[model samples]
Target: VSLQELMEPEAGTNRTAVAEFTLLGLVETEEMQSVVFVLFLFAYLVTVGGNLSILAAILVEPKLHTPMCFFLGNVSVLDVGCITVTVPAMLSHLLSHRPTISYGACLTQLFFFHLLAGMDCFLLTAMAYDRFLAICRPLTYSIHMSQTVQRMLVAVSWTCAFTNALTHTIALTTLNFCGPKEVNHFYQLSCSSTQLNELLLFALGFLMVGAPVVLIIASYIHVAAAVLQIRSAEGRKKAFSTCGSHLTVVFLFCGTGIFNYMRLGSEEASEKDKGVGVFNTVINPMLNPLIYSLRNTDVQGALWRILVGRWSLT
Candidate 1:
């Protein structure tokens, strides 16, 4: 039941808490739900497999052992984590009558969702810096992004993401869910006592999610400035092309994930909004490896040799 109903008809009543929550599925219609379910299933499969492939390529190919590929591997792991936390559970709830999720489970999802989401933000920013250093200041790129330093960057990103998730989870747990235990949208933490909850939610979206987007843009601006100094058109074209895929990913992730988070309280979460959420959480991960990184000359070359070389052995 909703937290409101379980309360003592008095404000600030946290004694009677909601034990479980009913999460919203993407669509209610049988046909639409089925279609979305299959789509999500396919997306999840592709997300996991595609990301794994990228990770594998990075690991197996000695040529991809640079700081760029190293950071990309971390991104792949974060992408997989981001999608896995939502899609599997969502798929199971597609048409089920028992759509109940325990309060603990809900918090678990919230924690990991924000955790990976935040990691995605920082990792992208870190990647942007990696790109900047490589393109803008190539001489110092190796010095700044040594294996030890890159590992530290990944660790710091992990710490920040964990802290963000922890804050959101703790903040959510303090609030009482009154009545109507059914989650109309995926799941949202609501507070009846104070306005602090809203501020906390907004901070997570803005500080953790929005902040990184800004940093990325700023980093790209610097990169662009440095690229313009190069006299050769061919040289400039190559630099921009290298950055194109990353820019595309930054927009896609921040645009949809932040939109869904902001949309939670403003309107009734419709199928379309849920679809956007799914795309952000599920399909985006799949698209990154497929559309962004997989088609790169380096990755493509590695895959070709692996596949074609295997045929020669056969």
Candidate 2:
């Protein structure tokens, strides 16, 4: 059925209160769908397992009980949540004859997706702030970023993110999706239906999205200044090394996200935007644990010890 047909249900009947929405799936062809199904499933599992491993290592090992590791554990948990919200649903719909999601479930998905993704942004910013303290203000870092303070910051970020998600959800629900129930992309939203919301989301999203990037940049600028003042070249290298992983993550997470949303504003990027969406939602989550694990000596040592510990036990 053409999109026009879905938009105009028999003129006599009312379709304002849509019961459900049909997704267009990832690719056009059935064969492509099967391939995407395997790919997405593999990505989801790796994302979950890798993040869980990060969490497990932190939990069993006492050395990882510091403020940095604690916040990282929170990021791992959010990464798991971030992927779970979309990938499982996308996977279920990938090969189904009727790729549909009910109204409430769809809205619920939108809510949690934003909630967790927003938390990811804030948490990264918080991590940058933690680094700022640990590096720039080393002596006062312990006093300023105590366990209680760290926990409180994390709790506040969650609360704020939850509230931000709720606001976006409310704005979305304000629009009545009475038109075509078929969502052209993998997710469920008729393009024509969301034009208004898309524009609004971008405008509002500047604060949600732009604020974090700005904050991260500002934090790093201060960090650079602090590093430059270090008398020894080795000292500066060590400081930058501690921050390298986080900066890489921030770029990967925000760079793809910005591209995806920027594409939302144009019709030409319809298909390409889907690819960007997949990158941010699926690929980014999977990469986060890998980035931290590979970049940090602490995570590497912990994982090594963990493997040997289990190996000896068995």
What lDDT is obtained when candidate 2 is compared to the true structure? 0.79
lDDT minimum window of 10 residues, candidate 2: 1-10
Model 2 lDDT tens row, 1-314: 01211233435665545566666666678888888889999999999999998999899878888888888999999999989998888887775656777768877988998899888888898888888888778899999999889989888888978887888788777765554443344333443467667666787678777988898888889999999999999998989988898999899888988886675534343666677778888999999889899878878888889889989999
Residue 103 C-alpha lDDT in model 2:
67
Over 4 Å off, model 1: 1-16, 95-97, 179-183, 186-191, 309-314
In candidate 2, stretches whose alpha carbon ends up further than 4 angstroms from where it belongs are 1-15, 180-183, 186-200
Query: Tell me, what's the RMSD of every candidate?
Result: 3.4, 3.2
What C-alpha lDDT does candidate 1 achieve relative to the native structure?
0.78
Q: So what's the TM-score on candidate 2? A: 0.89
What lDDT tens digits, residue by residue, belong to model 1 across residues 57-141? 7888888888877878888998889888877877777757555667688789879988888888888898899889999889988
What's the TM-score of every candidate structure? 0.88, 0.89
